[model samples]
Target: MMTHTETRSAVLSIGRVYCDLIFTGLDHLPVLGRELFASGMEIAAGGGAFIAAAHMAHAGRKVALAARIGMDSLSAGVEAQLRESGVDLRFVEHAGDAGPQITVAAVVGQDRAFLTRRAGPALPATLDAALDWEEACHLHIAEYATLHEIPDLVSRAKEKGLTVSLDPSWDATLIYDRGLLRACEGVDLFLPNLEEAEAITGSADPQVAIRKLSLAFPLVVLKGGAEGAWVMSSGRMLHAPAETVPVIDTTGAGDAFNAGFINAWLNGASEEMCLRAGIRFGSLAVQAAGGARLLTTAE
Candidate 1:
């Protein structure tokens, strides 16, 4: 097992912990009064924070998960997978109302859709302990919803001298908020997928969308799926093409990409290198049924 605590490069990944029920290789998406069958299924530990932390940990980073997990049977289903992730779970709270936090992900071809149930509150009770964790140097907020629930999170992390990164995980309601950019004011890095970027910038064009996002963030890296990724920093922009790999499931690929980019960025890697690392991780993610599944057996 990888050692912890002795490493001062720990990352605090804050978000909700979920039990992901994934279904892949479907004939078509289910519609009203219709039934669909999937060729394969898997139960795994999920949520943006956990998935990113797992991938980072697999890459040899000392990552700690700061989130809430439910005590229900549904939560039990993912317990072994969570423990196997190699993430520091000390900061994870097991609360009654915290879960049954579940996501039903269905994938068809390269497209996917999710139906999720969010329980209790978005912010975890361990926020104070996590922010004050002596080994932590960076904070990775998993979703915009978490930021929306705790608008002052970035400031809180900043006050503790920790660099912060935000991934605007798609929330239908919060994505269109006019104050979204304002809510992200103190974030050091902004990672958003193509759809979220277009929604935020009101531009379907990737080039224009990234440019608009770059103006607000010091570092903006946009995940463009098969087209690869784009990064803008200090008025300079760079793009890295995606790695070719078979697609098994697209679930959590963006979050996996975040881990690669962050791991590289924390090491003071060049902007181009960070983009390539993200692509590499994302490509690996799609070759499996769940976000961190490949990392479980990865060498």
Candidate 2:
């Protein structure tokens, strides 16, 4: 564990943590009752919060991760990986039994699927403690479920003079909730992939969806994998082209993008520069088998 130090611009990220079992080099997804073989496999600490935090740390930003993990060997291995990535884990808590684990099968040039099992409930208490930490200048809500579990988190973060961002990493049930916009009341930035944006705003057109969301959040960043990313802020829109890369897996690409954008934003970069930074990080992330592995190596 790294010793904690007070920093003026540290980022505190809160969400679920998972030990990811990533399998790559698959031609296609397996059918029901069928077995599929992958050419390579990698184990890494994953989760939206952890991935983003690791990338921020790699970028030389002071970042802390707050999540609940199990005391089991798998969880211990995940923690070791995170610590190696330079993320401050003093806020991470250990729960009963084993932590959440996800087995992801990523098909080359295609989408991936996940099979996840969670051992306990959301970590609202851990999140609250991290918010009270004075070192954090920015707060990132890594998943919508965490925000849902702690409804007042955004408001609480703002009250502490912290700028907040949220990546509503896809949720099947909560995306349709009409109160989703209300839940994001005080968030400074709202990041969502194309699918999640359309699902939340019920608009097929990306522009319409972003426009609707921008009304709620001061800045709205819509991530389009491969195609690129879009930023809607104030009354203007900005686009950043995605860098061409041979993608191995896109497991945590969006989370990496969030880290880039947030890191740039915290440093007072222009919106265009922030979008480019995000695209750069996301492109690099997909070139490897797992999200945190490439980032840790880069660091």
- The number of the candidate with the highest TM-score is 1
Alpha-carbon shift of residue 125 in model 2 (angstroms): 3.9
Q: Which stretches of model 1 miss by more than 4 angstroms?
A: 1-7, 296-299
Best by lDDT: 1
- After TM-score superposition, what is the CA distance of residue 148 in candidate 2 from its true location, in Å? 0.7
For residues 1-299, could you state the per-residue lDDT of candidate 2 as single tens digits?
01223466899999888888888888887789989898888998899999999899999998999888888888888888987888998888887644645555555665788877767777644766788888888899999988998888889898988888999988787988899988889998999999999999999788888999999988999999977999999879888888988888899999999998998888888899889889988988988877875544432
Instruction: State TM-scores per candidate.
Output: 0.96, 0.94
Q: What lDDT score belongs to each candidate, Candidate 1 first?
A: 0.88, 0.84
lDDT over C-alpha atoms for residue 201 of model 2: 93
Candidate 1, pairs of clashing residues? none
